[model samples]
Target chain A: MLTEILHTLPQVLLDGLTLGAVYAIVALGYTMVYGILELINFAHGEIFMTGAFIGTAIFLTMTGLGVMSAMPALLALILVLVVTSVLTGVLGMGIERVAYRPLRKAPKLITLITAIGVSFLLQDLVRFIAELKKGNYIITGPSLFTNQVTVEASSLFSTFNNAQLKSSSIILIVTAIIMMFALDFFINRTKWGMAMRAVAQDRETAALMSVNVNKVISLTFFVGSALGGATGVLFAVQYGTIDPYIGFILGLKAFTAAVLGGIGNIRGAMFGGVLLGLLEMFAAANLSILSGGVLGGEYKDVFAFAILILVLIFKPEGIFGKAVTEKV
Target chain B: MNLLEVRNISLAFGGVKALNDVSFTIRKGEIFSLIGPNGAGKTSMLNCISGLYRPTEGSISFEGADITGMKPFKRAGLGIARAFQNIELFSHLTVLDNLMLGRHTKMKTGVLAGGFYWGRAQKEEIEHRKAVERVIDFLEIEDIRNIPVGRLAYGLKKRVEVGRALAMEPKLLLLDEPMAGMNAEEKEDMARFILDIHEEMGSTVVLIEHDMGVVMDLSDSVAVLDFGKLIGKGTPQEVQENPDVIKAYLGEEQFI
Candidate 1:
C-alpha cells in the first residue's frame, strides 16, 4: 500500500498542479470582489463558463479560417487570453452597473440573491446561444497545445513513477503565475491600487480622499472578472471540453479556495488555490487506498468541503487568517 | 472675496432638521471656527460645505463657483479636504500610504498604466511620494511613516489624520474636532500644528472645535450655532461678548 502511494505521488502532484492553477486564478475574482464589496459574486463562475464558451468559439473560428494553427501557440494563446479577458471584463462591469451597483445601497442579502439570479440568468442565456450555434451546449474544442511531456521521476527514485501532462499544462501554469504576479504588483505598488485599498477600508472616507469611488468599484469588477474569464479559456483548452454549467461547481470550489486562504487576502487566495488543488488531487488518488475501499475517488469533493467545514469550525478567520478585513 | 460662501443652506432628513437656513463665509487664508454646544448643527454645516450633505434649500460657492450639488469627491478635487471627527484613517495601510492616498485625485495613472508599473508610472508615483513626504516632514511623523495606523497611539493617529488632509495640498481645509480626544499636551501640539498648517501652507481653514480656549486663540472669525440656527458671527472677542452667543452658551441664566 505504501509502495502504491509512492508510485502515484508524482503523477498526482503534476495533475493536481494543473487544476490548482485554474482554481487560484478563478479564486482571485471572488477574493477581489469580496474585498471591496463583501458580496460573493455568484455570477463569477458563470463568467468563467462564458469565457470558456467564447474562447472555444473564437478558437474554432480562428482554426476554421486556418490561422490559429498557423500562428505560434504562445501568440495564439495570448490572443485568446486578451480577447476573452476584455469581453468578460466588460461583462463584469456591466453586471455591476446594471445589477450590483443599483442594489449596492440596498441590503447585502438582497444583493446576494440578485447575484444568484444573475448566475442563473447567465447559465440559461449561454445555454440558449450555445445550443443554437452547435446544436449542443457541451463543446470539445480543438487543442492548440497537444504535445505531451513526461517527467522521469522514476529514474531518480525507485518507488516513484513517471508523471505526464500535455504541453497546455505548462502554458496554463506560466500564464497563471504571470497573471498572479501582475495582479499582486498592481495591488501593492500602483496608485489605483492604493485607492482600491482605501475604498475597501472606508467608502465614504475614500471619497473624502478625492478617490472616485464609483470608478474604482467599476475597475475592481473589470480586473477581477477579466482574470476569471481568462482562466476559463485556460480551463477549456486544457480539459478539451466545456459547458455553461462548468462554472457552478468549479466556482464553488474556487470560492472554497478563497475562503481557505483569508477571503480578502490576495496572496492568501493564491496559496489557498494551489493548496486546495494539490489536496483534491491527492485525495482522488489515495482516498480508496487510504480508506481501505470504504470510499472512492467520488468523495474528493466531499473531502474538500469537509476541510472547509473544519476550517470554519476551528479557524473561522482563515488558514493564514489575521485581521484581514482591510489588508489588500 | 470670501473663499467659501454658504447661502442659506438647510439640510433636513424627513422632518428632522440638521441645519436650517445656516449661512456663513470663510475668507481665504484665514482660520474660521464653528463653535456650539452638542447638536448645534456645526458639523452639519461643515458637511454641507464639504458636499457630504446636499442642503435642501441653499447653495455653496467655493472659489467663486457654486458647488452645492457636487459630489463629495468632486468637492475634494476643488481643494476641499476634511478630517472626520472619528479617525477615519485606512487602518491597515502605513501612514505613508495613507498620506499618499491624499494624492489620489492628483494621480492620472489608469489601470493598465498602473499594472505595468514602470517608466512613466514609476516617475509619477515618486513625484507624489515626494509631495507626501513633505507633509510627513511638516507633521514630524517621519519616524512613524511606515507604521500601520491601527497600531498607533490615539494622539499620533489624530495627527496622521490631519497629515492626510495636508497631503492633498488643499486650498481650503475642513477639520472636524481635530483635538477631540487629546490630552492637554497633545491638544497644545495639535493647536500649534494647525496654526502652522494655516500660516505656512496658505490654506483657508474651516474648523469645528469644542475646545473654547483653542477656538478663541486660533480663529480669525467665529460663528455660534444653537438648534441649527447661526445666532452670532464676529471676531472671537465680539462673538464672546454678544448677548445671543452668551444666552446660547449660558442658557439665559446669571453667571459669576
Candidate 2:
C-alpha cells in the first residue's frame, strides 16, 4: 500500500497543480469583489459557467470559420480568452448596474437575496441560450494543445512511477501564474489599487478623498468577472468537456478555498486554492488504500469539507486572516 | 471675497428638523467657527456644505458655483476639503498613503496606465510623491510616514486627518472639531496648525468645535446654532456679547 501511494504521487501532483491553478484564479474573483464591496458575488460561479460556454461557442465558431486551422492553438486560445473575458466582464457590470446597484440603498439581506436571484437567472439564461444554439447544453470544445509528455522518474527511484503531463496543463499553470503576478502588481503598485484599498477601508471617506466609489465598484466587478471568464477558457482548453452545472460545485469549492485562505486577502486566496487542490487530490489518490477499502475516492469532497469545518472551529480567521484585536 | 455662501439651508429627517433655515457666509483666508449645543445641527450644517447630506431647501454656492446638488467627490474636486469630527483616515493605509490618497483628485493616471505602470504612470507617481512629501513636511509627520494610521496615537490620528484635508490644497477647509477630546498640549498644537494653515496656506476655514476657549480664540467669525436655527453671526466678541447667544449657550455654566 505504501508503494502504491508512492507510485501514484507524481501523477497526483501533476493533476493537483492543474486543478489548484484553476481554483486559485476563480478564488481571486471571489476575493476581489468581497474585498471591495463586502459582497460574496454569489453569481460568480454562474459567470464562470457562462464564460466556459461562451468560450466553447467562440471556439466552435472559429473552427467553423477555418480560423482554428490557420492559426496556432495557443493563439486561438488567447483570442477566445480575450473575447470571452470582455463579454463576461460586461455581463458582470450589467448585472451590477441593473440588479445590484438599484438595491444599493436596500437592506443587506435583501441585496444578498437578489444575488441568489441573479445566480438563478444567469444559470437559466445560459441554459436556454446554450440549448438553443447546440441542441444540447453539454459541450466539448474543439481540441487544442493535445501534446502529452511523460516524465521518466522510475529510472532514479524504484517506488516512483513516471508521470504523464499534457501540454495544456503547462499552459494552464503558466497562464495562472502570470495572471496572479499581474494582479498582485496591479493591486500593490498602482493609484487605482490604492484607491481600491481606501474604498474598501471606508467608502464614505474614500469619496471625500475624491475616489468615485460607484466607478471603482463597477470596475472591480468588471475585472473580477473578466478573470473568471479568462479562467473558464483555460478550464475548457484543459478539460475539453463542460456544461451549465460545472460552476456550482467548482465555485463552492473555490469559495471554500477563499475561506480557507481568508476571503478578503488576495495572496491568501491563491495559497488556499493550491493547498486545497493538493489535499483533495492526495485524498483521492490515498483514501481508499488508507481506509482499507471501506472508503472510496468519492469521499474526497467529504475530506475537503472536513478540512473547512476544522478550520472554522479551530482557526476561523483562516491561515492568513488577521484576528480581531481589541486594544487593552 | 466671500468664498462660501450658504443660503437658507434647511434639512429635515422624517419629521425631525436637524437644521432649519441656517445660512452663513465664509470669507476667504479667515477661521470661522460654528458653536452649538448638542443635537443643535452643527455637524448637520457641515454635512450639507460637504455634500454628505442634501438640505431639503436652499442652495450652497462655493467659489461662485452653485454646489447644492454636487456629488461629494465633485465637491472635493472644486477645492473643498473637510476633516471629520470622528477620525475617517484609512486605518490600513500608511500615513504616506493616507496623505497621497488625499491628492487623488490631482493624480490623473488612467486605470490601464496604472495597471501596466507604463509611460506616464511612473512619472505621475514620482510627481505625486513629491507633492505628498511636502504635506508630510508641513504636518511634521515624517517619522510616521511608513506606519499604518490605525496604530497611531489618537492625537496623531486627528492631526493626520487634518493633514489629509490640507493635502487637497483646498480653497475652503471644513474642520469638524479638530480639538475635541484632546489634552491642552494637543489642542494647542492643533490650534497652531490651524493658524499656520490660514496664515501661510491662505485657505478659508470653517470650524465646528465645542471648546469655547478655542472657538473664541481662533475664530474670525462665529455662527451660533440652537435647535437647527442660526441665532447669531458676528465676530467672537460680538457673539459673546449677544443677549440671545448668552441666554441660549453662555448662560449655561456647564457650557462656559
Off by over 4 Å in 2: A152-158, A325-328, B252-256
lDDT of each: 0.92, 0.90
Off by over 4 Å in 1: A323-328, B254-256
Q: Which candidate's TM-score is highest?
A: 1
B38-120, model 2: which lDDT tens digit per residue?
88999999899889999999999997899999999999988999999999999988999999988899989998888899779
TM-score of each: 0.97, 0.96
- For model 2, name the residue pairs that clash: none
Candidate 1 local lDDT, A1-328, one digit each (tens): 9999999999899889999999998999999999899999999999999999999999999989999768986898799999999999999999999999999989999999999999999999999999999999999998768888999999989999998888999989999999999999888888998888888889999999999999999999999999999999999999999998999999999999998998988898898899999999999999999999999999999988887898788877777658535546
Query: Per-prediction DockQ scores?
Result: 0.86, 0.79
> Where does the lowest 10-residue lDDT sum fall in candidate 1 chain B?
B246-255
Q: Predict model 2's lDDT versus the native.
A: 0.90
DockQ-based class of model 2? medium
Q: List clash counts for every candidate, in order.
A: 0, 0
When summed lDDT is taken over every stretch of 10 residues in candidate 1 chain A, the lowest stretch is: A319-328
**TM-score, model 2 to reference:** 0.96
